[model samples]
Target: MSSGPRDDDVLRWYVGVPIGTNPLILMDFATVLVLVWAFAITAVVLLQLFFGHSLTGEHIQAAARLATRLVLLAAAGFAIISFLLLRNRYTALYRLDREGLYCENMRMGWGEGGLGELSKSFHWRPFAVPPLRDPAKSVTKKVPWRLVDKVLPLEGTRTLLFKSGRGTAARVYCPDDGTFERALRFARAHIPEDARSGPEKELQQS
Candidate 1:
């Protein structure tokens, strides 16, 4: 049986994901904002150039102004909804030693001022029609080495899955090469033999 990290030498890994990593999120905010604002500005300018010299077009001018405001408002509303739907990923911290394993999910949030701190203040639209669960984010967890039932290495996804005897589990997604190898190594060294899921064994061979 292989032993885990020493008490005096715990192994640690950290992962931070940026909002711009996914192009879908970027497109959601960027495309809508650009298209809506551009259309509204263009419409207003065209109306002024075409009818500004007219003396009896007060009603037409008022209607154009109102339409521009409505378009801008609709665009802003959609952008806000997209922001709430596509919340950012949380930071992940993993610690493993001879005794146990610990995984923490740190969310990014506005600090007291504008420092952008991490906190539990991650409040999205709870009643969203599509229900945004933010699968990339994880909740905090701690488990003893013995209580761990299995460790599965997801290759294509570059993630590690830790299942516990108490039915609790944690999934760590690797954003880069460093985190993926470190997590796989930690799971192999610490997890018990009987708890090796099929994929985990393949990871060991490779």
Candidate 2:
């Protein structure tokens, strides 16, 4: 029902997440690439077995060669696509207040030189790469304190995961240790006592 938080009502900051910097982001891309490669190889093998007379050593060898080629080609394409989509470091605007948390991914522009520049060239205009989201628009999510059922901290990534009954409500990425501590303290004070996870003493020690 609420439109969004007013600027004066919250603490706001911008965080830049560059490609290959966050393991969580990298893992997501890797998972997708693996799935694509597996599906392609599976489909090919299924088709070969369906139409072939019998499973022979030669058929297996041929399938192996095809699979290898497919994996290499898929990997290359995945890397290219990932670079094109993420070349511009992702910028997220985070706003926190007594009420809840708000996160918005600002529009991004391609950087100069390399693939970014190549994609913008007139010669490649027809096949130009597009951003994952509309480059001119931002995407936002708002999570209220009342709706938050759990607060999970990931020390490795310096990220906080807020979860509701449905699933993950929102994710907050901290830029540094100090910021992470501040955010965690805020979360502890606002979220329900029962919803807190992990050792409180360990957090205090850190």
- Candidate 1 has its poorest 10 consecutive residues by lDDT at 123-132
Candidate 1 accuracy as TM-score: 0.45
| Model 1 lDDT, residue 130, Cα | 15
Worst 10-residue lDDT window for candidate 2 reads 121-130
Candidate 2 ranges beyond 4 A from true positions: 1-9, 57-78, 81-88, 110-135, 164-167, 198-206
Cα error, residue 82 of model 1, in Å, equals: 8.4
Predicted candidate 2 versus true structure: per-residue lDDT over 21-97, tens digit per residue: 35666677677767766776677677778887467777666766776677678667655654556553455667789
Clash pairs detected, candidate 2 = none
Q: How do all models score by TM-score?
A: 0.45, 0.65
